[model samples]
Target: MTTTPPHTDPVMHAIGLAVTEARGGDPAAARRALLDLWERTGVTGDPLHRCALAHHLADLHEDPAEALVWDVRALDAADALTGARVREHHAALSIAGFYPSLHLNLADGHRRLGSFAAAARHIDAARAHSPALARDPYGDLVRGAVEEVADAIARRDRAPRAPAPGPAS
Candidate 1:
């Protein structure tokens, strides 16, 4: 038998309110609400709330590249954050896998920026992070997307580098 911490409920309720606001077309307000929740709950190390915050940040960004930064922050927050409060969240995500989504989104962002090497690196990270991604229901779509991007990066790399664009003749 297991029991949830008392603080967990409050944090979840606050996160839910933020998400509801974000989904209801007021992302800025949602972002503010989540930030307040972070401050109130001191949820820096709680993987669930950190992931939610990161997703909120990503959703608020106009640029995919900016969103990638938030995605990476989310991963880092999960990886480095420490506290008894987050143990269950970490354990659950470890069992479920979290890295592939981070790497795939990062790779997609890098691809959009024409950063082939970076894109490939993140794709490789995605693959390395979740070798059995194809077998995981939650990771399958990201895995497929990463495979396509990886293929595109390989093709791009094999092609000769074009002459740098200069002033028109």
Candidate 2:
């Protein structure tokens, strides 16, 4: 007879399950389930879950600033993960987290909200994550544009600010 593995933390399991559901288009249930799972697990400080929940919530709300926060959290979690599966998860997230699809959505949202800088940042992040764009003809063009935008942002950020004048004569 085959033996089944023991179940892990119920709340963590529920959060994972909730994320799956959210990805499948059940936003309401996913949100409720994630909140319940977090409450039950007392997992507010878990960077991974925090990031995952934040990203999914941002997606549901079309909020790039929120999503950006989550993305940073996710990167922190990735750095701390020590398991084999964690490595795999990190690899996947590193590639998928800044995918053009989501980045484009964020850019559009930011643009509509009059956040040109945020929109540009997302495009830059998306391109940075897509280093292998040469393999995809269409993606290469999009990546090229993203690089240009990033360059422009960098130039603007680097431009020298005028020095303050002396206080008194």
Candidate 3:
């Protein structure tokens, strides 16, 4: 007898396809696809899909500033979800586990925009929410990025400031 694979949410499936397309070299197309999905979902879509779409959209932006906007939206969407809703969407996933990555992305976006204080705040949030596992590749990547950004901020602080030019003659 033939058997079918387990069911996955259609929204989640579309997100996976869009993300794959984005990674395959047509970011614009991927962005368009995601936007379409977002419109279809409207304000009442599952929080999980909203969060995932916003997160992916942030990465597709060319400007870090624009990316930050999407990142904030993603965080807001995630925050709107309750633990039970999260469990309903994906039994294996926890809402708490999503925060670290969201914060890490925010930190990176802020760091790219030279907002060291904001970046540091998000980095701290990421650390606070990170899983206790000894070795998660995603966690390690986020930690490494955090360290790099921290060092960059430190160097910027230590660098001598150039004297401001007086009024033009």
Best by TM-score: 3
lDDT scores in order: 0.64, 0.49, 0.73
lDDT (10s digit) by residue, model 1, range 47-70 = 666765775566566676786777
Model 3: which ten-residue window has the lowest total lDDT? Answer: 160-169
Q: Candidate 2 — what's its lDDT?
A: 0.49
Against the true structure, what is each candidate's TM-score?
0.65, 0.48, 0.80
lDDT of 2 at 139: 60
lDDT for each residue of candidate 3 in 7-103, tens digit (9 for 90 to 100) = 3567777887887787777889989999999999876777777898999998888788898998998998999888776666656567887887788
lDDT of 2 by residue, 1-169 (tens): 2322213434345666776676676868877776665455343465445544544554444344554554444444434444443333443233343355345445444544556788687766676567644455556655654555455454544222221122110
Better of 1 and 2 by TM-score: 1
Candidate 3 Cα outliers beyond 4 Å, as residue runs: 1-7, 132-134, 156-169
Candidate 2 residues lying further than 4 Å off, grouped into runs, are 1-12, 23-25, 40-44, 62-85, 88-109, 132-169
